[model samples]
Target: MPKRNTGRRHSVSADQIQKYLQEWFDLDNKAKYNKRFKRYLNYRDILTILFDRFPDLKTAYELKEKYIFFNRNTSLEEAEKGLAGLILEFGDSGIEEYHEFYNLLINWNKEIINSFTIINSRRINNSFIESRNNQIERLIYNAYGYTNSKRAKNRIMYCLNKKDSYTM
Candidate 1:
């Protein structure tokens, strides 16, 4: 198997476990059953054995998946309660790593909860504004030493109103 650029090197079994776990837990993996291929079958066998051998790892993995599920499925009204329940689970989990994550979540509780707010059926975010700012900065850099303010304004408006525009 080819190595992934995961920053840290892992043993073959560790890499296999990571790969299988991601494939299994991927939100976009809509297939009800995995492909009946030899490679996938081997990975499944390895994961089954690993899960049986290390129940704590299994529990941690399940808890990690719970957050992903919650984020995708919960409504804005349900988000606060759902996240609180997750935080409680993380606090009670025996895993030391989760306890650290629990503290981090607690520290950013308000901001994380606020991120669940939806407006006009879309999640509220600053991406459009940030992108516009970046575009303006690039234009300004490219148009350095320009004395024509009106022409610069027109250029900015023209560039920002293209077919693939993200403007409001």
Candidate 2:
């Protein structure tokens, strides 16, 4: 008999991955079902929408920025306080999903937040990301013909700035 794995040692079954693949397949199919259809919102897309509406999450961002970009002389206590305040602010924002995520944050705070403290000078630029995204969209449209092949569509997309393979 195989010894039972316990606690956090659970092994993933092939079924789980297959299920996720099928789920995404369904989502993509739905997205292409009609010309007027909107693609299903994934997690990051949903968060982007939320941030657009409620942009007052600066405290949360500052804590993340402090750890991610400015690690010169940050103490652990300061990081802890900043995270605690961010959690409190989110919880009190009257957002239902935020409260649930806040609970998860409190539960697994230690592991995920551990030294979320890496300092790098260079920050990412949105313009570059947008351009790269356009490049990828063009590649996809060309390779799979996901979008309409009208002259106007091709002209607009062809105007994107060039990118090297390294950017991908």
Which candidate gets the maximum TM-score versus the true structure?
A: 1
* Model 1: residues with Cα > 4 Å off, grouped in runs: 1-40, 126-168
The local lDDT score (0 to 100) that residue 143 gets in candidate 2 is: 60
Model 2 clash number: 0
lDDT (10s digit) by residue, model 2, range 136-161: 56666556554555744554455553
Error of 2 at 32 (Å): 27
Taking all chains together, each candidate's TM-score versus the true structure is 0.53, 0.28
Q: Residue 146 lDDT in model 2?
A: 43
lDDT of 1 by residue, 4-123 (tens): 333344567978998998987665544343455334334446567678999988889899999999978888788889989999999888898888899988998877778788888887
What is the C-alpha local distance difference test score of each model?
A: 0.78, 0.56
Runs in model 2 with CA error above 4 Å? 1-77, 117-168
